[model samples]
Target: MKLVKVYVTLKESVLDAQGEAIKSAIQTMGYNQISDVHMGKYFELKFENDYANLEKDVDLICDDLLANPNVETYRYEILEGE
Candidate 1:
């Protein structure tokens, strides 16, 4: 089996209001050391077979489901097990 880990986040130029709100709350709670918080999404996918075509399938998933190519950026890693 192959395990895929996907991470999706807004582009640097895009505004992240949710992340800002969380940072503000943290600061109010006396956490002043943190700065520039960014929000992101994580997804884990398991493939039942065809390890040889893993990269192609993962690219398709990223393009079609996991990420919005217009504004969001994403990266994925594959873990193999015996």
Candidate 2:
């Protein structure tokens, strides 16, 4: 078995309202070093070792289903075998 770690985030050109809200709330609490914030999503995909094109499959899923190409971008890594 293998573990796939996927991270999805909005492109720099897009606005991050959720991240901004969180940063503002934090700053209001007196931790005022926050200059910027960005929000994102994470996914862990576990699959058996049967598939030959796991990386390709993951890329396809990220591009087609997990992320919005115009507004978001994604990157992934395969974890160490246990």
Candidate 3:
């Protein structure tokens, strides 16, 4: 089997409102050293090892559904799965 780890994050030009809120809460907790926070989404996908078009399909999935091309971006890593 194969494991695909996907990470989706807002583009640098986009505002991360949720991340800002979390950072504010964290700062209230006395973590003054915290400078910035960027929130993102993580996804884990498992597929049969024999999938011939795994990379291409993963890119398509990310482009079409997982990440928004207008304001978000995604990256993935393929790994061996138990």
| TM-scores for candidates 1 onward, in order | 0.90, 0.93, 0.97
As a TM-score, model 3 comes out at 0.97
Worst lDDT window (10 residues) for model 1? Answer: 47-56
Ranking by TM-score: 3, 2, 1
lDDT of 3 at 15: 95
Query: How far does residue 40 in candidate 1 sit from its true spot (Å)?
Result: 0.6
The residue-level lDDT of candidate 3 at 26 comes to 98
RMSD to the hidden true structure, all candidates: 1.4, 1.1, 0.6
What overall lDDT goes with each candidate model?
Answer: 0.89, 0.93, 0.97
In model 3, what are the clashing residue pairs, if there are any?
Answer: none
> Tens digit of lDDT per residue, candidate 3, span 1-82?
9999999999999999999999999999999899999999999999999999999999999999999999999999999999
Better of 2 and 3 by TM-score: 3
Q: Which candidate leads in lDDT? A: 3
Q: Cα deviation in Å at residue 27, candidate 2?
A: 0.3
- In model 1, pairs of residues that clash are none
Task: Name the top TM-score candidate.
Answer: 3
